[model samples]
Target: MFDTWSVRELANADHPPSVPLNPMGALPCIARLEDETGSSWWVAATANRWTTTHVLVLWRPDPRNHRQERLVWLRKADVRPWLHKEQATRT
Candidate 1:
């Protein structure tokens, strides 16, 4: 299923989202996702070393241990207009 989320919702998540990384190291971009279950997930998008596209890493804070986190990788295309729109507003 598909769902839309606002940049405000992400910024208000319990745990602040992680910053995306670059070849030179961490960049200032911060992305987040909201799932069907209403759980908020943090995301970090970094450019691939070889490709012009980006790799999005989704993260959720561990329920059992807040200090720990879980993550999964996704293509930037999955987030579509939301991610693209958010990035545009940032600049």
Candidate 2:
């Protein structure tokens, strides 16, 4: 996604980011999904915006500096079928 990526480090004097300049460039991202069969599927997708099914974020604060670190993002989905399958397993 356009917003999911950033420069890992300052690669140039101008500090240009590694993100592609193309508006339709594929997002530098990946996803891992596990089904009821205990098999996992890795999904590859392109994006120009952040998708709930493509990412998530968690944040923690730095107690020493009293400042919070950047949010962490994860890729997951809220598929109804998956929910039902999980519920079935519990029962």
Between which residue pairs do clashes occur in model 1?
none
| Model 1: CA > 4 A from native | 1-24, 37-51, 58-66, 77-91
Write down the worst ten-residue block by lDDT for model 1. 45-54
Tens digits of per-residue lDDT for model 2, 1-91: 1222232321111211243333443343334433334444333332333343433322222223425333223333411121235556853
User: For every candidate structure, what is the RMSD over all alpha carbons to the true structure, in angstroms?
Assistant: 11.3, 14.1
Error of 1 at 57 (Å): 2.8
Which ten contiguous residues of candidate 2 have the minimum total lDDT?
7-16
Report the lDDT tens digits of candidate 1 across residue range 1-91.
2233222243222321444454433232344565545665444433221123433433334334445443333444433333465567854
Alpha carbon lDDT of residue 15, candidate 2? 16
- The candidate scoring highest on lDDT is 1
After TM-score superposition, the amount by which residue 30's alpha carbon in candidate 1 deviates from its true location, in angstroms, is: 1.9
